[model samples]
Target: MPLPKPPVRRARNKEDNELLIKGMTCALIGAVVLLAPYLAKSASVQDLMRQAYLVGWFALILGCAFLGRYALRRLAAHRSAPRG
Candidate 1:
């Protein structure tokens, strides 16, 4: 049998970066939600959902913050690449 071709990589660009950040945020939040029931619940489903919402919000905010930092570092590296 012939070898299969590797999957094609998407172009790395601003739009892609935005998408990546959004995807990561969603994945992390979803993971938190899936585990919410297993976690400690105060009184009812309302409380549990409230906690989940707060946690999810923070997770996304932190993810975006780190993504922005990474972008800045990449920009700096690119600028300093040709040190002559």
Candidate 2:
């Protein structure tokens, strides 16, 4: 019997997935910021602001991490690419 063919490669790569996930993460952060006050109107506004601030920081860190990873990968690829 003939051997099976190799699996097909996907068009999307690791960086694309990372970008998608980061985007979703940031969107959730925004959603939380918008939803928190409505969900807990009785609580002090200052407390909600504090919670949103924390979420903002997390979103910032996540975006930075993704950006750094993407940059390093592209730089490595550029350095390793064959020059004509």
lDDT for each residue of candidate 2 in 1-84, tens digit (9 for 90 to 100): 977765543443565567757856775675566566766666697476656766766776676676666667667767966575
Candidate with the greatest lDDT versus the true structure: 2
- What are the lDDT figures for the candidates, one per model? 0.64, 0.65
Which residue runs of candidate 1 sit more than 4 Å off their true CA positions? Answer: 1-27, 30-47
For model 2, the local distance difference test gives 0.65
lDDT tens digits, residue span 17-47, model 1: 7756775776577557645666756568647
Which pairs clash (backbone N, Cα, C closer than 3 Å) in model 2? none
Instruction: Give the 10-residue window scoring lowest on summed lDDT in candidate 2.
Output: 6-15
